[model samples]
Target chain A: MSFVSLRNVTKAFGDNVVLRDVDLQVDEHNVVCLIGASGSGKSTLLRCLNLLEVVDRGEIEVDGQTITNGQVDVNALRRKIGIVFQAYNLFPHMTVIDNVTLAPTKVRRVSKADARDRAKDLLERIGLAEKADEFPDRLSGGQQQRVAIARALAMEPKLMLLDEITSALDPQLVAEVLTLVRELAETGMTMIIATHEMSFAREVANKVCFLDEGVISEEGPPEQIFSAPQQPRTREFLARVLAAGRL
Target chain B: MHEVLQKFFSPHAFRVSLPDVWTGFQLNLKLMVIAEVLVLVLALAIAVVRGLPGRGATPLRALAIVYTDVFRGTPLILVAFLVGFGLPGLNIKGLSTLSNFTYGVIALTLVYTAYVTEVYRAGIESVHPSQRMAARSLGLSYWQAMRYVVIPQAVRRVIPPLLNDFVGLQKDTALVTVIGVAESVQQAQQFSQNNFNFTSYVVAAVFFILLTIPLARFTDHLIRIRERRERAQLT
Candidate 1:
């Protein structure tokens, strides 16, 4: 059984069609990298998986439970699937520790003492324990994204979604966040990332998917997709990324 | 100078009866306090109604727009007259018999709730939609997200504006004097009428300025804190 699956998913915003009859699957404990040009619906696809953007038509299952079409309680489904955005959307008024602990304390109804201890441990794991009491404003973009990751992990999600999580960071800050994601991959956390960092995608992902105009144009092992793509579009994309010296 | 002192500064002339001043001050405080509370509660309700989900949202928004436009378009003194005198003549049975104080409270609440509603709406909207999404994605219901996350931030965001509104309420309490509610300003006017001294008028001005200046400074301090936090975020 697939750990996560989307069957015949379709989405649209007004007259603009975003995703059309998209089907995908993620096995447990695998990193799947989705690469696409601008406006290819990669972000929209990730949002649909988390139910942040509901599917107009189709079924989405996580750990074999239906989450789309109002059949499943969205709150319960979302708690099992964590999502990280390109922008580190940390609550500005909250301390880092507070941000990490909020969901567990409020939604999970965990005791304050347990939440605090767990938050501290997660912050330390993300290498920002000393900055726990500081506000998100006080951290660098790289540090802030790490805190956001820690915040998502506090829920102990079964699957995590990364929507170009490094794109919004500064060039200097990008390497640190990618490194963190690489470590998470090594730990066998199931992840689906929509990203432009082709080198990191090639290095860390087991499977590579090239999304073109809201459809998966080609997909294969990273070795085959990066160096020996079969589709002309994928080859052109790789050439541009290689000329830029990234892939 | 001696004549002037005797007329305006003599202990007998300047000495106000403690019981009368105390009674008047308490009534004034009560009026302002109750009016402020009522305005805050009603404004929040109106803002939520206008912002709530559904087809009814448009009509609620239209009603809020009209209420705000009419109240803010006219002066509070006019509202006082309509509530205190004009409405009574309609002899709406039970309503006409309400005390002057009750009429004053009703008028002030109606007038200020409109302004407060706008303040609250701006504050609630100032919080980014992402914060609400973050809360909802964590398994909170929509109302839970609003009550715990959105409202707390909204309250913090609008504190300076809300405090400014409170100062306006403090000064607007004097409008009740038009309805014969004997608050401090009205009591002072009565004293001056009996003795033909302008000192009572001077005292009233001093009292209001003394009360409002500190609040203005405090609001300034709060704005500074907010600005510093914003700057920190950017840098």
Candidate 2:
């Protein structure tokens, strides 16, 4: 069994099928990137992995545990995985430090002091230590997003999911957030990124999966997938990304 | 003009009725305070229950929905009569013999809770669903997400509206008089009937105005602060 595995996973909302018969595997500490067009099920796939959206039919096993089983504890399962969003959904009412420490203290039952200390350290690492006491609304988009990443990391999750974390950022601000992801990759934090940044994927991903119409049409190493895509759909997506100057 | 002022706002009537009106107003104050606390807690519970996700909570949500719908539609005076006189008429032993004050509290609580529950539900809905998703994605349970993230933002955003409802509650405290409870309006009515002048009613209105003006201003201040935060990203 791999560190993380999804077998025949399918999810739908009413008549709109978001994911269908998706199979993927990730070894511990490997950075896998899912690249595709919008509405291609990238975000939904990550959401299902975290159990934010339940799979209509499939088996998802994380760390040898079959999380898709009905009896599994979703909260405890989510504690092991951290997922960040494109919009950087930091709690607007909470300060930066409070946002980071909330899950550690409330969900994991860590002591408040310990959570605060860890949150402070994570903020420092993310280069937002000075913005600790400031409310999220007071921060710039990049700063808020960095705080959000720190908030997720504060829990020390086993696997991180980055769901187009930079898609909503200003073009100039994208690098700072990606720099932190690269640093996390260097530290060997296992991550599955759903992103549109093809060049970033090419540089940072161990493997890339091209999702087309709710299915992983092709999967392989970044070098192979980006340079020599096997499927025509993969070629077309890369061509479009290239034409848009993203790759 | 002087005669009109003298009839409605006479010094003699004000002085003669001040003591009695003030005493009666204390009962109104008590009802407002007690009812406000109960509505604050009970409304939030009903609102949360109404918002619980999945089919498992269908019955519970239905119950909460029915409660809000029934109470929201009933007039406070009618509720006061139903609770005040009707409960006693039910002759349900221990509960039937309860004081009119307690009955007044119950009526105000029921009616105001329905109104406030809608306010709280509106506030909760105003918070972007993404906020709840982010909280849940971090391993927080649904209630935990509501407690630590959603409700706080929702409550904060709706403070002005919540206070607006409170002003309505404060005013409606007078409705308890219909239940034969001697709140300020009833007291003022007595003095006005006896003296054949409405100055005592004017005196009661002044007292009510004093409390609500401050609340309205505070709500405005909070609104201004929130607006500034959104517009300028201020600290």
Best by DockQ: 2
TM-scores of the candidates are: 0.90, 0.96
Tens-place lDDT per residue, model 2, B11-125, is: 9899999888899899989999999999999999999999999999999999999999999999988999999999999989998999989999999999999999999999999
Best model per TM-score: 2
Off by over 4 Å in 2: B1-3, B233-235
Question: What TM-score, to 2 decimal places, does chain A of model 1 have?
Answer: 0.97
**Candidate 1 structure quality by residue, lDDT tens digits, B7-47:** 55555645563344446666777898999999989999888
True contacts kept of each: 0.59, 0.88
Best candidate, lDDT: 2
lDDT of 1 by residue, A1-247 (tens): 8898888899999988888888888899999999988799999999888788988998988898888868788888878888887888888778999999988988889999999999999988888999999988889999999998888999999888998898888899999888889999989999999999998889999899999888888998999999899999999988988888866
* Candidate 1: stretches off by over 4 Å: B1-23, B56-74, B81-99
lDDT of 2 at A127: 93
**Root-mean-square deviation (CA) per prediction:** 3.0, 1.8
Residue B80, model 2: Cα distance from true site in angstroms: 1.1
